[model samples]
Target: MKEQFAVDVLICGAGAAGLMLAIDLARRGISFRLIEKAAQPFHGSRGKGIQPRTQEIFEDIGILDRIVAAGGVYPPERLYHNDGSYSDADVMERGKPTSAEPYHLPLMVPQFLTERVMRERLMELGQIPEFSCELVDFVQDADGVTAQLAGKGGEETLRVRWLVGADGGRSLVRHSLGIGFPGKTLGVRALVVDAVITGLSRDYWHRFNDGDMTRQISLCPLAGTHLFQIQGPVPLEGDIELTAEALTTLVAQRTGRDDIQVQSLSWTSLYTMNARLADHYRMDRVFLVGDAAHIHPPTGGQGLNTSVQDAYNLGWKLAAVIQGAPEALLDSYEQERRPVAASMLGLATRLLEAQKHGNMRRGREVHQLDIGYPESTLSQEQPERLDGLSAGDRAPDALIRGAAGHPSRLFNLYKGPHWTLLGYGLDRDAVPSRAGLHIHTFGPHGDVIDEQGHFYEAYEPAMGDWILVRPDGYVGAIVTHENLHALERYLLQVGLGVPGVFNG
Candidate 1:
């Protein structure tokens, strides 16, 4: 028999972006249905790393530490050269040093493990995905969206106020919107292998090159087998075809790992330099996210991270709008995230192009981010004016003293969807206050709170001051040591059920 279930949002494709968005929305009591064609979570880690920015978001949602526990933690960034001597770059220093910590270096975990942790969190929230369900067709009206879905038994119709296509590179929602995703197809194909190796160096990311372009290898340290991605322009000797066997041979030849056998083949796939972006990120009531919005060259390992960040960026907007926030708030999702996506795609493409053209310096420069969030139209607003800043940028992770002087990560306070204000230097103590907002104080001495909260004793925010953090862990808007009208403005502008008057 056919089924009919109505939700505020209908999410297609239960991948990382889809599932994360689902879990986040579920936490807010926002009704949503996440559909995945897969019977269960795919085995093996697809992506091998999670950036610090993403970790901050995960921490905000209250499951990052759990993710670290479930999927083994990856160390720092390490790059190896053919000279036998390896010099590593500090990823934590990749961009401008914000007063945050986690944004410096990303954590290493495969995409499958990420899915596992996210799914576990979803289960905890009582919103498991609607597995085996595939999106068939969808139509949007002024009021809502009606989508056709198919699964094991039959077809069902779900009426939702919004539609999110997290379906990956070949997104049907993108096609339905008639948005163009023009990308060049790289003629080269590379093989990726993930396995446990004991003897290999254990820094972070290691790469082996021929000192030229003959071959290149990227070694990512995972729980067991260091996930290795080896790529080079094909044709070793003569008219040779690029195949899995050829890649295996190349891996053996490059890493000098002919003896280090792969323990368990978690994931293997062929990848090409697909540099493309959708002409539009949003169309009417249906929006696109993750791989559906853009595909970048895998130079900086930003694919999965970018997708997850996209979920963080859009999830709140969708939930807020559905809960009666101004529709203009929803429109800002595309406005803010699209620019960041374009920037990442361009940066990744530049890195790939520099590598392909043998410009190592250019590749390194493009891979690094000295500045951020300002290039976008949404970036012009400062953390000063609004009660809160735009929710589109990456949030930072901070270390703080929790209630009772327990040390904790600043991201910990953002575990729920609420306006959390952190104050210091007040004559008194810190706790939730009169405005229904969650308020806390970290005194002069910073102490560790829980296991998830690690006090590094280094790199702490300015003490004896007030800081207002959003539920997603970003600094929404901050005021000097006192409560101001900015809080009310922030609540009305970015909060649920605010008035947004659109001029046009």
Candidate 2:
């Protein structure tokens, strides 16, 4: 016998992508079911580095504070030379927080800690993901998707308006849909472990590499914890036990340090380098995100951050579509995200190749703050100069004085799940009121005053310019006139408005 349930969306994996998607849908008052095949949350520091852009996304979703409290900055790395000499290199550069970018550097939070924070946030929102639940099969039609799930209690059937596969690389959802995951296997198998080791300082990331950089090992201290995340390339023609003694011997042999001893091992995994992308992100009503859509080498710490961004991009769109927005909006997901995923694969691959050639320093490009969809069809821009940032760019933050005589921020206004209509040099009454849209005037005698001129310089809006920000914080449309009709048309073009009004 089997029970049945229904939801607006069914998420088939409780990893970063699935959990973030669940949180977004829940906040929007959209019903969703989040399920994980594992009985408990993962207990490893696999994807440890959270990029600055991902931190901003977490801040907007109300989990950034927790993440910050549980994490610390990336430490500089100490390189051990094969000739018994060593030097230090700053693997990640630190910067001061500014109005334009609050999160200036990547954070070092264990992947498990990050998941715990996300789960707690979801609990605060009155939703909890079901663990030990597996999606055995699924079928989709013109209306919805029907899935067969097996959990601890029993088998159940779920009918959902849409389905999202955030499962890892071996995604049953993508395989069931016959989507082609095409790419090469980079042929480097790495051994990763979480353990307590002796004879290693916690001040810097300790790395040992051979002259040609073929064999390497690194032990990075996990902040706020007593353990270290260890990684090394495994030789193809070797026989080694997956035990503490074997790992300890391997670490000592590779680093030429006799005193270093692996005190204990808590977790371990063997992963191969595979750079593959699903032939498509969307197949009819079902969509794939995260590792289900693409896989990357761990060179630039992009896997988890990219996965979280994918969820952020898709979540609000899912909410809007459920709220009577045009179904055609779903098409934009593949159009916008697949290309980004492909580019990330290329970047990570290049980093891997560079590392092979002894360039181990992570560069600024890995921060991922400049990724955008300037060529997206959802982005609309006028024929003006379009300097600085135009449509499809991430909206920059600015400091301002609010009507309540208090200092405020542009990000504060754009925080929630709504469209924002920003009037740079208009009257208070000029910014119209509409549902699902926030209006703010930023000039003298208006709702807000750009006392610092940051807003003016950041956007550089013309006298009557209006900028429309989408829920995901991208510039949707840029209008240069006081034309509410043009704004409405822009909204409707992006599936954010009805026939005659903005869908508030």
Candidate 3:
């Protein structure tokens, strides 16, 4: 496998999105390579929350249990004004877990842990990121992309059918392509310090904001450790000189953890964020995902989750393109994920504006919208029913059974790069006609998975009678095979997922 070779896909910036894309591609048995500029993988705790939809994605990739075992799930958030406490709910409605499914709630793992899990998963699937190998530049043509790779030995190039920049907000790939990222800088600096504590604060995360000022503090729980950060309104020209001592004072003042000892300081830095998106996620043969496409303030902690979700959306499309599915499938990547990035950018923007308002009023107002998407037309046959179930918006959680006839949930089937088909209609065995689709049938209570095998457990009559899910873990469409042609249109629109075997 070593040579001046050509591949199907080339991924830049082997962080969250890059690794996710790599892993998903590997699961689908696609030929690909992921490259990163760092000498080694990132080990610091950065972004600190995972939305429910994202959890469903990791689960599908066969790593959510490890993530949960690593303690990636952040507990419910505890919020307060400068004076009194208000809610421990997720502020985004992901706080409460329903009683039926395997994963009823969202996890709060740190960004670094999330990265480690994604990286490990990629390794498991057999693609190690070429560390110390940076994409100096890339050349794209009508047929493929040739990316210049550089390391200690100078430079070499590898040609691939498609190129993706998951590099970072300051993406070299984006810069090389001369694409413009449009957005505003907050000037407000977030002073972050991660340390191991003896007696850390009890609350998961807290924000102290009254009428005029805002100081946001968060505690991220790992398997046996905690990483904490204190953020507030700082002048646009904040200096780097204020290090551990200053951040320690802020945390002590906010969380009332004066007695808690900072046994070991892990990392510290000031990161100012921008609420911006690329003018376009795609530019000819080169495309962008994650921060390279958009960046947002760390308000609701959507950074890593959004990027990982972006990979879930794009991976299958990329795989489809490689498998001779259709170029149209690739087109929908920007169409679908750009809106998601826009929605995330909107939420972060409003929260930043709310912080400027200096009141809890706007903060609460902006935080309440259920930021989710509806099902795509490509795979399923049930739109109205899916729309009723949160469909493509953000996936809703419900308990069901696994392929083994044991107790499981809908979100768990999301573990791979394939589409998840939940069949409950009269044609329980009739899933989408796609070849690579991961279809699961729940007799009712969904299904379950253990060390033994997958099985159907019980039944939840309230959920849509039947549904076809996308790789990103949202419903693709629901069907009793009604209009049938509607399914064909969706299949053509998204590409790749052969509506019937003949197309494959």
- The TM-score of candidate 1 is 0.76
Prediction 3 TM-score vs. true: 0.79
Expressed as tens digits, the lDDT of each residue in 394-436 for candidate 1 is 3445565555756656566667766566554443334324332
Which stretches in model 1 have alpha-carbon errors above 4 Å?
1-5, 70-99, 183-188, 195-207, 218-221, 224-248, 252-265, 353-409, 422-436, 440-468, 478-487, 496-504
Per residue, candidate 2 scores C-alpha lDDT tens digits across 210-259 of 33445688899998689998888786556647787888888888888889
Rank the models by TM-score, top first: 2, 3, 1
The residue pairs found clashing in candidate 2 are 435-504, 436-504
lDDT of 3 by residue, 1-504 (tens): 433447888888888889888888888787888888999887766776565556666767788777887764444456655455566554344434443233434555766777887888878878788889888877888888888899868898888888989999899988888888888887766666666655545455555443344445554444335555544555456365445565567667666657655555677766776788898888887889999999998766678878887887788777766666667667767777788788888877777666566422222223212544443334343434422443554445555445465765455555555555565533444545566555554444334333222222222223335555566656566555554565455555555336442221
Better model by lDDT, 1 or 3?
A: 3
Among these predictions, the greatest lDDT belongs to 2
1 against 2, candidate with superior lDDT: 2
Per-model TM values vs. the true structure: 0.76, 0.96, 0.79
Q: What is the lDDT of candidate 1?
A: 0.64
